[model samples]
Target: MPEVVQNVSKEGVKYIILGCGRTGYNVAEELAKETEDLIIVDKDEKRVEDLRDQKYNALVRDFSNPGFMDGLPVPEVAFILANDREANLAALKTIKSRYPATYVIARAIDAVSVDLLQQEGADVVLYPQEVVARTAIYHIRKLHSSRLALRLYDLLASWEGTLCIVTHLNPDPDSISSAMALSLIARHASHNKLNCRIVYEGDIGHQENRAFINLLDIKMERLTPQMLEECGYIALVDSSGPGVNNNLPKSTRVNIIIDHHKNNTQPPSAVADFIDIRPGVGATASIMTQYLMELDIPVSKTVATALLYGIRADTRDFKRNVTPQDLNYAAFLLPLTDADLLDKITSPSVSLETIEIIGNAIRNRKINSGYLFSNVGYIRNRDALPQAADMLIHLEGVNTALVYGITDQNIIISARNKDIRLHLGNVMAEAFGSIGEAGGHATMAAAMIPLSYFSMAKDKEGLLTLIIDPILKRFSEIVGLDGEGEE
Candidate 1:
């Protein structure tokens, strides 16, 4: 950082760009559009002459000379981008010592030079190899995404009539936003010949999720038995399979699937015409955002806001299960999103059911050796289970939290863990996969067992009490506690 003065001479040049190589030339070209009060310097006489011919303020001078810039006014900033890394460092030190108020951006030879340049008073260090590597990765991903977008367009073009986009049961922000993006893609690709409808099976009872849908005016329908027969094509997003986390029948024929979950063992049963599931990504909305960019589709403010929030929610604000692609996609959407609407969607008031569920989870929590397990009693909204787990995991001395609740037809469970020694997703899958469907990322996971699995209980209340012990015991034992934490 450089010294901040209240005012400087408007007649003086604002920027001094040393080492007019490719990097420096490109930067100056862009900056020239904003102002002509800038100088481009290079030690090569021929290079400086060529730049001068192109109407640039180019100068040939040795940077090692302490008075090379003797006749010039003190520029506000200097860019020392040269291939000669050592020479760049020398120029940086000279500039900093003489013009202590000027900001200096210096190039580094390698990774090690980065630290040395910063220590030598360079305000910013630029490494050529790191810059090229990052740029190469972004272009490579864009190329791949472009090819995939073309395939998706071709598939949509071939289809006509209704196309149902099914999200996971009790749809969250990720699923809802991904569905919106897919619907937009379908309409654009098919030239509006396709009627895209978003469908889900469970209640949108989560307060934040409800706010997201309403504030964005997203249109969706509840899944019914007739929905399968009515829609000509079916696509699932956020959830990989037909029946894994959604109410779709296991045997239903799915036409398309786009999800980000890691499915190591149980792959989707229905063979689809198109499937893009990347386990490394944090959110399906990120994948959808990539499609929009590569295909050159117009994104509305509402859609961008939804997709941005979706990425943040699923990645825990880019803190969990995130990848480079997720971050890149989120950055692409940032400028297009509506910040005020995103604030409203994320900060919705909690519902009474959710508050009650969290209270029950805290009151009934049992902890032993950093492991905590709680039963939230009977719940109408299964989404509350994960909210409870997320809250309980913050308790003092608790490294893992497991929260379960009984619905009318299923026993839903959600767990969160921060312990380095445990992969919570694998633990949940191994403990409950035999009786129900379960699996997720390293930090978080979920499972759902049908009420029929515990048919011995005569009523819902009894069933809630009946399965608590076995659930705790199985989870504790699998994690090496051997039922020590069970009631």
Candidate 2:
């Protein structure tokens, strides 16, 4: 168990458990150690007696009955663990409808029920069989000698054709490094049976990103529709769901997906045969690092440096949304990584256009209740918008920053937030998702709205108003502001 999980405290919280089956009993027993205010209810007299004998608060009543719940106190947490699907559903509905504020967790018997329970207002739905299978896999991998990696290798070894590893468009350090690490894994796993190729779409225009790719010698091909059709197996790294940010078509059959984004709107199992999406993990490189460690694969200095940089970039040098796994992997990769090469990658020469973009952002910035917005007119290097947004958020009075500019056929928007209460990705999605594809992490997000969405204006100033006005209007609606005019 991780130290973080073990150290979680449930002090002063009340728990109400419905059903006294093996699952419920076990949960109540464990939770009893955390808090004293626990109530266990069961329809069976024998099960109720069992809890009573153990000196636990027990009630003999139908958990699905609204009368039974009406007499009880509104608990902070409620658990429905009935074996019958209908009974569990009834209990879940009752708890949610009666105690709307309570956090309810219900047991699910099958994969189909998981979705149903969630739709019915269960805050969390537990599937024991799936949990057990996952736990078994975890233990089997740990106890056996490179069993998980070997199993993955065996699967790749069976393939007699090409394997394509795809990364998100405008590949970041995490996406690029993760693809390289997966390619390395495939090389070690199947020798030469699987011809693995790394591919991506969009420009690597960021100075640091280009330097990282060049210094590490990470080779990636530009993905095309024809190339995708020729591959036997497709693996997505640091990206989940097709047709989102990746170049892969929605109908493309994927064999594997490894990503750290928790808010993947697509059902992972539907798109890939082998899915490993760990939202708790800060970076996909950390996940790949664990696999390398488990397989005992030799980590070359170049690979180490890339993986370390991936983790650092994703976590913002461990200053933003970080997890224990990221810290552990960073520690593991630190010694093997080339420090001098890392410094070189980090200190790339900035372009004059990027400097001018930042200057324009500063001069044209507008602030509304701690939220700063900037329009850096026509920018060739679209990547500089994000760099400027990140810099603008560091201003003393700013809690959030949005920077946008016109480039080619798209109006690119990059957003950053220092406020923990705001999810910038969701904000971006709400503001411009209908016009374009927009989504990202909590602190950092980006949106690309096509130029066709705006009415073409003849002059520069008219075009600026035509392009930026709608974006500001939508954003202002979301943040509850009455339109802060341009500075």
Give the TM-scores of the predictions, in the order they appear.
Answer: 0.81, 0.67
Candidate 2 TM-score over all chains jointly:
0.67
Q: Which lDDT values do the candidates have, in the order given?
A: 0.86, 0.83
- Candidate 2 lDDT over 1-487, as tens digits, reads 1112121144323888888788998999899898768888788977777777787777788866666775566779998997888888888888788779899989998899999999999998899998999999988757663565566656766776788999878899998888888888887777766788899998888999999999988889999888888898899889876765586668878888888887776666445667777787889999889888887889999889999999999888998769987999899999999999999999999999999999999999998888898989887888899899989999988988999888756788899998999898888898888988788878899888887745354454457657588677898789777765533
List, residue by residue over 283-329, the lDDT tens digit for candidate 1.
Answer: 99999999999889999999999999999999999998889889999
Off by over 4 Å in 1: 1-14, 19-26, 35-37, 42-60, 64-141, 268-270, 453-458, 482-487
Overlapping backbone residue pairs in candidate 1 total 0
Please report, as a residue range, the 10-residue window in candidate 2 with the lowest summed lDDT: 1-10
Query: Deviation in angstroms for 344 in model 1?
Result: 2.0
In terms of lDDT, model 1 sits at: 0.86
CA shift of 331, model 2, Å: 1.8
